[model samples]
Target: MTPSRFLRSALAGLLLAAGTAGAVPTASVPEFSDWPAGTAPAEVGRRVAENFAARSFQWQTDPKRRYVIYPEICAWYGALTVAGLSGDTALRDRLYAKYDVLLTPEGAARVSPDAHVDYRIFGVVPLEFQVQGRGDAWRAIGLTYADAQWGNPVIADGVSPEARWWIDDMYMLPILQVQAYRASRQAKYLDRAALTMAAYLDKLQQPNGLFLHAPDSPFYWGRGNGWVAAGMAELLRDLPADHPHHARILAGYRAMMAALLPVQGTDGLWKQLVDKPESWGETSATGMFTFALVTGVKSGWLNAKDYAPAARRAWLALVAHLDDDANLAEVCVGTDKARKTTKSDDLKVQYDFYQARPRRSGDLHGQAPVLWTASALLR
Candidate 1:
């Protein structure tokens, strides 16, 4: 079945369970009729999806890694999502065909063997294929990564051995497990994701509601917090309200959203160092935050009257950064959290490191969130 069909069946099941047709809950999809001329969700979604479809598989260029990196996997997942949400069968088929290559021996070689958070996140693509009515093979391949993440005998504080308390894991870990739950309807996957998020919240979330890059790294790095926002929003979309961790996760998400409201650039972008006025506006973070806000408003976690305009403004501003080729500009290059040293000058060095990072166009980090935002708008 197509994604639209799957959605309809899911909704039908929900309605049947409610025992009254009038009691059914539905998510509202915002119409693009009133959006700016060129920034409509459909237009931008199609452009980015086509750009992705036309590209060759991307691998890590630095250190010359052999496997496909997480950013490309993320972009691929987003394209698949927008394809399904928009009911673009041709785009859907094209994406599936691309994924089919990875199932082959030659293509499997491109998949990483490591269990690092970045590598494990590749599972999200195949699990997404499974959600769209693909075969069990996709689920099997996807679950191997998800299950292995917890395979270590020494999990600490209910967190995965892979957990490093880096804010990026906020999105990396939970999204994979959540997709696992969606495919299998297994409580373990959801439990793992929810418990892990709660732990991260306790470790990293700040009084200002944004996350630091790490517990010791004091600055609010834009993409790092973006990961937190997107991850929470994705988990909430599927997490049952009665679940033990739901309220905590919801409170964390709302707090982050409230914090973001005041910092959005007048141009609708957010800066690389989110709290620093002098930091350059960054595309990837803006896109990720837009997805979070759009998801929140649609899910009624946030009031439309309060968040809808911000979401719309963000989408328009982000699309304006996309070049004719559909590549987003002013994206901060891939960043690693700074390690605190004994030197007293360390904090300033770390802060300058973020401020001085190179801005590139067409990075998968930037590309992925634009597709994510589009998918959220359509969802």
Candidate 2:
């Protein structure tokens, strides 16, 4: 037999021999150090992404109940990127089926009449479907949602949630606007995105270039800042070079990258509390930043000499978090900057509150950003 076939057969035999009652086969975990630099992110991304697909990208579920939720839908954003790059038809088909179920005949999400900005994040997937020639209605649904967001009283001040700005909106709002712009070629979509981002930067950006979680909060939460960085990068990617505010958005992106460079942990990750040295390293933020940095370098927006090492380090550190079966570890659960677990927006969470948040395995927050980073890396 050929060496490859012989090796596979022998390994299977050995695993069987080693099995005991109810014992699962041990996975032969590969070393990250051996992975080549140029293609490491994409290679690792494929493994983790496929594992996610097999499990249907849902963490815990009732077999009978299937509906799109915000978190998993966010993960699909990354998986869709990989699908486009790798041309993996099976993966793309599965995503299309889910999108089909989520939308109506006219392409609106199936939800209560009072759906909010949170629901609008689904605007992106339909644009993906339209590219495949089956999502025309889906594209309309996404555009209609953008109209709703523009008219929402919550953003009367030109940002989400009425009064105060939150870092999380960075990921949710601009992506839809950019995708809408991509689908319809409408300047209004791009105009709305730039206006909102400019408002956010004016409110939250600190002197050193990092952003506050909210104006009332003092802590620079890692993933929150990561959201801002990633959002700015995404906007610049689509915002035309001749667009009125292109220079301003690019400036904000570079400033955030400048602040991020010095704070990265020796291990190549950022802390849960970004400026707090004692806080633990966080995977999701690290992955997001890696994605932005690599993208910036590749796009000619960032200087390769200054940022490449940081990008490479961040990528490698992110890979180290993946387990034998491709599950990403140490992802913080969904949290806001609420202090003392109180009901008010002014609640100030203790430093330990961030440091102590539970870490999860295979969370979409972490998984999605990893794929984004992988897709950004040069093959």
Candidate 3:
């Protein structure tokens, strides 16, 4: 079904609210047509991309910490490589150095139990570099990282390999698996990659449609589901139509997406609690979903005209949150939803700490979302 175009309905209201407050002369949405060329899509994306890039650093590492294996760094690299292609070779070089730590002679990563599951590094990075259309080396750094981390199998610190969570296995690992599968034409890597999500797919179900994190975890962290959705978006490159599981994978993606449609907030963005509806609006998750849903529809895995408006509305809502520098604001920082049991990072965040906090427009964890959102807007 065709969706209706969004009326610039919120523009006048927002402008009026700003007028009485003696704020900067805010323009109505209708006046968006009259705005200078500086606020175009490419420019905003460029600005946010620049802001996100500046924060892009070695995760958990500084000049003082020295270098070490970090999964979050790989996540950063997966998106960073695409971004740096235009001019950020310096940032790309930083990722290349990190990838160098994991690549093995066997053409796969050498992940250790030293860190978490960052399995999808393979599908996103190219292991073998061709020299002017010659010399393709199938040495896979993304896969090698996965193995090195999983090989040692850490269980004592807090989590264990047997303690399976779905999203990481589904999205992070499959990206690399598909990348390897395409390069080697080996069914084994693809098979293992396909199996990674089985546990999660089998276990994930919410009465309203959004997939829950794990069997025991009920709170549906928006970004958690975003990872799964984005991974599915990336998987289209490798999975063939006749592959045994292709149909099922698509089915699962739609089921998860269907769960998202009903919960979009009136402002055109999703709430912090996707299923909870009443939770405050959150940009990181909303932006991610907006990216996935739009990309999914464009890919034909979802219906475009029907869903893109929500994406557009959410995107329009998202546009309003930017600062003069085009940087984003009010995104939630990283937190583990599984740690709901104790007074961990959650309750310890006292108002004393909150109220006295430095005034800022961005958070560390919002980097990926900004990157991801720019990708969506640019598309």
Best by TM-score: 1
Tell me how candidate 3 scores on lDDT: 0.51
In order of appearance, the predictions have TM-scores of 0.89, 0.81, 0.66
Worst lDDT run of 10 residues, candidate 2, spans: 20-29
Give the deviation of candidate 2 from the true structure as CA RMSD. 15.7
Best first by TM-score, ranked: 1, 2, 3
**Per-residue lDDT of 12-98 in model 2, one digit per residue for the tens?**
344334221221111211221245653465577677667656664231354443345566656777777777777778877776776
Highest-lDDT candidate:
1
> Cα RMSD (Å) between model 1 and the true structure?
8.5
Candidate 3 displacement at residue 106 in angstroms? 25
Off by over 4 Å in 1: 1-33, 60-63, 153-155, 340-345
Q: Write the per-residue lDDT of candidate 1 for residues 150-250, one digit (tens) a residue.
A: 88724457767888778899999999999999999999999999999988876667756788786567889999999999999999888888888877787
> What is the C-alpha lDDT profile of model 3 across 266-355, one tens digit per residue?
987675556666566777677678767755655545555466667667766767777776656757554445534333344333212222
As a TM-score, model 2 comes out at 0.81
Error of 2 at 29 (Å): 28
